[model samples]
Target: MDVTVIWAAIIALGVLLYVVLDGFDLGIGIVFPLFPDEDERDLMMNTVAPVWDGNETWLVLGGAGLFAVFPVVYSTVLSALYLPLVFMLACLIFRGVSFEIRAKANRTKHLWDLAFIGGSTGAAFFQGIALGAFLQGIPMDGGRFAGDAFGWLTPFSLLSGFGLVATYALLGCCWLVAKTEGDLQRRLRKLVWPLTVMLLGFIALVSLWTPLQDPAIAERWFRSGLFWRLAPVPMLVLACAAWMRWAVHARHHRTPFIAAIGLVLLGYAGLLVSLWPYAIPQGLTLWEAAAPRESQMFTLAGAAFILPIILAYTMLGYWVFRGKVRHGDTHHYH
Candidate 1:
């Protein structure tokens, strides 16, 4: 195995971790406005409050790993999506601030609640837009970014943004079902089927749009000898979605959430496989975008130690807080 490939996989793992962990919390925020009952809303907030900040750590790891291991890819992609990235960061900041202050503000709690929802929606939208733009392929001329600033704003990007909003909200709904009881749980149960249908529709659209947008992706998946082997990917994703819907209907709260995570993981796997060897799809290969070997080696050593600690603590935190978030119960960070 090449060192560059190892680093690429490490970054991909970090990205997957961040998407799965932070994604649920972001989805919770996106669906915050749906529950008008203050008690239910507080329970929803309590479900994620203990580890929301820790969940974000995987994102930082992903970003830092990309910058360290693939400087060219980082510089190029970041430069191309500069404005949206800035907006995403701003939204994240607002969301974090709102999380810390919302409970403290007795009179202005609604204002903070609004900010949280807005920030979560904005962050998820722009992240999806950035992803869509990347899938549409970067406008590279002589190995440099040659597109205009607003090139990221396209029909596909907009659709992708909305798609992610639905996807995240579905995750949130499933999570609430797993982490709450009584009225809140029942309410979330009703949302699971509709959100599942909506998510499947979005996934279908994106799946079609992705191949059409990039001939390489289309050819790689449809025309290659590897196509038959990889064909099960979509099938498995859909199967998970179906199982999640069934689980929610059956009142198997934990099953629905687990199935939801599985669905997202399958989709992520399909994507990484589709774009394998290319850090910046259609342009830069992993080796091409990788930094100097010395830099990679140095960071590799640090990652070897730090990633385990992060993983350990993350698991421990979840284990500690593993229970239903009941209404009127005080949520303590132990």
Candidate 2:
């Protein structure tokens, strides 16, 4: 691969890494309040405490890869998705504060708890919106961004925003079941059903909207022969989800959670394949917007070294925190 292609691969990998790493954490935050019971909340928090911060490294890696390698794509995508980006950044900030403050506050931990929810929701929803907009393709002019500031706020974007939120929440609940037991686990099982239902509904709505928004996308996926090969991804994901639903209710729990993660991975891979070779959906081909070869080589060298180390530490953190979360008696955390 040339500089542009290699760098594109790096950044794309970074984004996928972020989706896999922080994805669960964000999902948990969105689903946290599902169980209003304080004990359940503690159990849920414990499940993520050891690794949430580390999970955010993927976001950093993705951002840095963009800045270092594909500066053009970064600038254009950010400029077009400025509103959603700002919303996402603000959510990350609030969520971080809430994470620490909730553990220290004496009387008003409830406020921090609420902040976590808001931040997580804001971050997850805006991310989905941005994803939808990107997939819809930005309007580019002379190799730069030329999109309306509010172009991202279409109905399709909003629908995608909710779809991601629901998707993350379901994943979060499944994580909770895997990490906790007793009343909390039972509560999570109950929660996953509605979230699952909502996920299916959102996907169906998006499916209907996709072809309407862009006939090309419709042809690529449904009308053209590509659908024969591409269609299996969604079908596999659906089968996995059905199996997860069955497993979650089968008095066996971990298998369902594992299956849910598999479903997420497969579905995401399908989207990536559907839009491969295009850095910005149908706009700006990857090589057309690539950075200098020397710059890419330098950045790749550093990432190749650092990425694995980060992955190792992330794995270690999870391993250390493995098992049931014990949040102590009814005392206020902060």
Candidate 3:
């Protein structure tokens, strides 16, 4: 068995879990301004409070796993994208602080609210920028990053940033639909169709624009035999969008969220399809960038042991918190 491939799969799973789990909460912050009432905002915040921090565990796992198993890629990519990564972390810190302190603040509550919104939006935007930069391929020399500090800021990256913001907003809206009721839920449901439309627009733009930016990617999708095999991905995305719209129109709360997740997974799958075999896009293959086989084997054993424990606790947290968050329900934050 290829232990490198195993480790790569593990890390991919971790990243996907992080994006899906944390994306919605960050999205809640993205759409916070739409619902101006303090009580409504509180209810929105409460829906995610118990599990928001926990969702970030996957990010730590993904990052640490990359550093351990693919140190070369980790070092090179981090160095290339240092500025944006730091900005993303700063946003996350402010978002977390605002998450915890927003409930307690009286006079400055609005400030925290703004922080939450700004932090979430900034973090999501930067993440997409980093992704676009990575996808467009990092410049490398002798297995080291050979890119400018501001290379990540580009038209494609900017488009990707806005795309992710819309994606998260849609995810957050679907989540609220399942987790709240009455006027807030109704308003949230109303937002769902438009958010879905907006997300689809961004997805289409990214899908077309990425190929234009990188001819190799275009060749891989078009001239290569890979096109027929990967055809279902876009079809599935359309199906998920249709299902989400129908669910919202039918007033079926949970189905829309499930469909939203389906859309995310399909989009993620398309990305993986676009950049398979290469750990650092056009720069380095996974095998070339991987740590020593012995090191990967050792780390895999530990990850194998720990992954289940993390999965167990995550499942437990969600199960325990399952149910609609009502307006007057007493929360731990209070």
Q: What is the TM-score of each candidate against the true structure?
A: 0.97, 0.93, 0.98
Model 2 agreement with the true structure over 3-105: per-residue lDDT tens digits: 6766667677777767766777788888877668765666677677778888888888888888777688889988999999999999999998988878778
Winner on TM-score (2 vs 3): 3
Overall lDDT per candidate, in order of appearance: 0.87, 0.79, 0.92
lDDT of candidate 2 vs native? 0.79
Segments of candidate 3 deviating more than 4 angstroms: none
Tell me the tens digit of each residue's lDDT in model 1 across 194-264. Answer: 88888889888988888898899999988988789988887898788889867976899699888888878
Best by TM-score: 3
Write the residue-wise lDDT of candidate 3 on 48-102 in tens digits. Answer: 9989999999999999999999999899989989998999999999999998899
Write down the RMSD of candidate 1 (Cα, Å). Answer: 1.3
- When 1 and 3 are scored with TM-score, the better candidate is 3
Name every residue pair that clashes in candidate 3.
none
Model 1: number of clashes? 0
